[model samples]
Target: MRKALALAATLGTLAMTRALMRDRHVPLPTALPGRRETLSAPQVGTVAYYASPEGSGRPILLIHSINAAASAYETRPLYLHYRENRPVYALDLPGFGFSDRSRRRYTPRLMADAIHAVAAEIRARHGGETIDAIALSLSCSYLAKACLARPADYATIGLISPTGFDGRLSGEGPPDGHRGREILRDVLDRPLIGPLLFSGLASKVSIRFFLEKTFGATKIDEGLLDYAYATAHQPGAEHAPYCFIAGHLFPTDSTLLYDRLKLPVWMVHGQRGDFVDYRLAPRFAERPNWRIDSLPTGALPQFERLRAVTDCYDGFLASIRPSSPRG
Candidate 1:
C-alpha cells in the first residue's frame, strides 16, 4: 500500500510538470500606444517596433533591455513621454519581443545591427535626420556598438542603468568574444531539460521575482508584469531567454566599446537595485562628452521617477546644439 501511494504521488508530480511545460498560444499585446511595424534586418529578421512620428525636431530611437520577458514596454515611459515632444520610436530586439525568436545563437552583433537597421529606416523617412538614441540596462552595450559603427547616424545617445561597470565583467576581450560558457550553452540547448527549464523561468512568479530585483522594490508596474507574462507565454518565447541565461547575449569587450565612443553620451542610473556599479563611470564623467546622473529609484527609474528622469535627459539634450544631419 505504501509503495502504491509513492507511485501515485510520482505520477501526480509528472502530470503537473507536463501541464506547466505546455506552451500556451496566446496573443501578445503591443507594449505602447502606436502602430506596430517590422524591418527586415540582415541576420536577425522581422524586427518589430512602435512608432509615433508626428512630433517635430530630431527623431529619437529607443531600445529596451534584455531578459526573459523583455520588450519595448521596458522603454514605455520614455516613449510615451517623448512622443508628444518629438518623433519617438521603440524597437524589440532580436530575441525577446516581437522580433525573430527562432532557435539560434542571439549575439551582440545581431542585436546591434537590428538597431542600425531601424535607425537607417528612420533616417530614410525623415530626410536623413540624425537621431538621438536611448537605451536601458544591458541594451546600452548594443546601442553603443551601433553608435560606434555609425556615429554619423546618431546625434547623441542615452544610457540608463546600463551594464558593464560591474566588477565581474572586464569586457576587454577580442572582437565579438562573449562571456557564454560553452558547456552551459550546450546544456541549455538540450532537448529534454531545456523546455522545462525555460518553462520554470518564464513562469509569472519567476518573472515578477526577477523584475522585483530590477526595480529594487516589492511594488512593480502591473501592466508591465501582465505584458511580460503574456509575451513570455507566446510561441518561441523561450529561445532568446536560454541564450541570455547562458550569457551568449553579452559580448566580452563591452566596456572597451563604451570607452571608444566619441559621441555625446547621457547616462542615468539608479542607486537602489540589482545593477548599480558606476565606479568606472567617473573615468568617462571627467570627459566633456559624457554626462552621468544618479536617481533615487531602482534600475528602471523612469517608472518611479519619470519627471526626474525626463528632466535630466532633457537638460542633457538641450546642452548639445543641433547639427546638420549630413554635416
Candidate 2:
C-alpha cells in the first residue's frame, strides 16, 4: 500500500512538471508576413493570406500541403517566384498554420469550402473573377474538389504530388482503413496529448532526419527547419498532422473529381517524392486535358530544384493564354 502511494506521488509530480514546462514557453499562435490581407470564411474561420497587387491578369492561388508543419510561407519557393509576374495568393488552410481550428471534423469538404471562400474573398477584393489554383500534396485534393464544384471560378488548375490516386486504383485499396482511422481519431481527438505528441515529433532533429531520409538529400537548411518548427508549434497547427495521418483530409474519390474537371489541368510529381504515388500519374495523364511533369527530385522537387521547376511552370503558363486575354 505504501509503495503504491509512493509511485502515484511520483507520477503526479512528473505530470505537474510537464504541465509547468509547457506553460513556461507558451507559443504565439499567429505568424504574419511582411504584408498580408486578412479574410474571413464562414465555417473554416479567418485566414491570414499574402497577395501581390502589382501583377496583371488572373491571380494564382498557392495551396500548401496539409501537415503539422504546413504554412503559406513554407511554400514561398512557388509563391515568391510567381508573385512578381502574376497576382498570387498563398493560404494557410484551416487547422493548419495561422487559420482557425474550431471544427471537430477536418473533412476534405470543409477544406474545399475554405479554399472556395478564400477565392470568393479574392474576387470580391479585385473585381468578380476567378483565379488559377496550384495545390501541393494533400491540399491538391481540396483544390481539385473546389475547382470541380465551381468550374468557372478557377481559370486553370495545377496539382503537385496529389493524393486520391490510391482510392482510384484497385491494388491501392481504401486510402484510410482501420489503422489509419484509429491514428487520426487518437491524434486529432485528443487535446493535450495531441499537442504534446506533435511538439515531440516535430523537433528539429526529427524534421531534419525526415527531410534527409525522404528527400534523399544530405543538405538540410536550418532556416527551413526553424520555419517548420515554428509553424508546427502554432496553436491548432499540431492537429494537422493528426488529420493527415487519420486521412480525414484525403479525398476518397479524387479521381472522379478529376474526370469532372473542365479546365486545363497540369500535374507534376517528383521521381523520388516520398509523399506521392508517382506511378499513378500515367493514368491521370491518359486524360486529354491533363498533362504531367515528372521531376528528378523528391516530393519537394520544387524546393530541391526551384529554378528548373519554376522554368517548367513558366513555360506551361506561357503556352496557355487567358480564356479572356488580360489587358
Candidate 3:
C-alpha cells in the first residue's frame, strides 16, 4: 500500500508539471495603451511602437529597459505624462513587446539599429526636426549608440537607472566577450530543454518575482505585472530574453559615449533597487552638458514618483539652449 502511494504521488507531480508547460506554450497578447504602429526597420524587420502626437514641438521617444519581459507598457507612466504636453512615442524593441519576436539571436547592434530606424520614421513625420530621446537601464546603451551615430537626430537625451558607472565590472568586459554566452547558447540550442528553460524563466510567477526585485518593494505595480506576464507568454518571447540573461546586451564602451556626448544629457537614478550602483558617476559629475539627479526610490522611480521624474527631466531640457547642427 505504501509503495502504491509513492507511485501515485510521483504521477501527480508529473501531471502538474505537464500542465504548467502546456500553459507556457500557449500565447497571450497583452492589451497595450496608445495607437500601435509598425516601422519597417531594414535590419530588424517590423519594429512596433506606440505614438501620441497631440501637443507638440520636438517629439519625445521613450525606450523601455531590456529584460525577460520588456514592453512599451514599462514606459506607461512616463509616456502618459509626456503625451499630455508633448508628442510622445514609445517603442517595443524588436524581439520584445508586440514587435517581431521570431526565434533568432538578439544582439545589441540589432536593438540600436531598431532605435535609429524608429527615430528616422519619427523625423520623417516631424519635418526632420530633432527629437528628444530617453532610455531606461540597458536600453540606455542602445540609445547612446543611436544618438552617437546620428547626433543631428536628437535634441536632448535622458537616461534613467542606466547601467555602467558602477565603479566596478558592471559594464567593463569586451563587447564581444560575454561570459555567459556558452551556457546560454547551450540552454537555448539544446533540444526539448531550450523551450522548457524559456518557459520556466517567462512563467507568470517568475516575472512577478523579477518585478518585485526590480521595484525593491512589496507593493509593485499590478498593471505592469499583468502586461509583463502577457507579453512574456507571446510566441518567440524567449529569444531576446535569453540573450539578455547571458549579459549580451551591455556595451563595452558605454562610459566612453557618455563622456563624449556634447548634447544635454540628464541622468536620473535611484538609491534603492538591484541596480543602484553609480559610484563611478562622479567622474562626469562636473560636465557642463551632463545633469545628474539621484532619487530615493528604486530602478523604476517614475512609477512611484512620476511628477518628480518628469519635472527633473523637463527642467533639464528647458535649461538647454537650442544650438545649430554639431556636424
TM-scores for all candidates: the values are: 0.92, 0.84, 0.89
What lDDT does each candidate get? 0.86, 0.69, 0.81
TM-score leaderboard ranking: 1, 3, 2
Question: What tens digits encode model 2's per-residue C-alpha lDDT throughout 285-320?
Answer: 776566678788877766788887877776776777
Which segments of candidate 1 are over 4 A away from where they belong?
1-21, 322-327
Ranking by lDDT: 1, 3, 2
271 in model 3: Cα distance from truth in Å?
A: 0.9
Give the top-scoring candidate (lDDT): 1
Best by TM-score: 1
Where does model 2 exceed 4 Å of error? Answer: 2-34, 166-188, 191-193, 321-327
Candidate 1 lDDT score at position 183: 84
Q: How close is candidate 2 to the true structure, as a TM-score?
A: 0.84
Q: Which ten residues in a row are the worst by lDDT in model 1?
A: 318-327
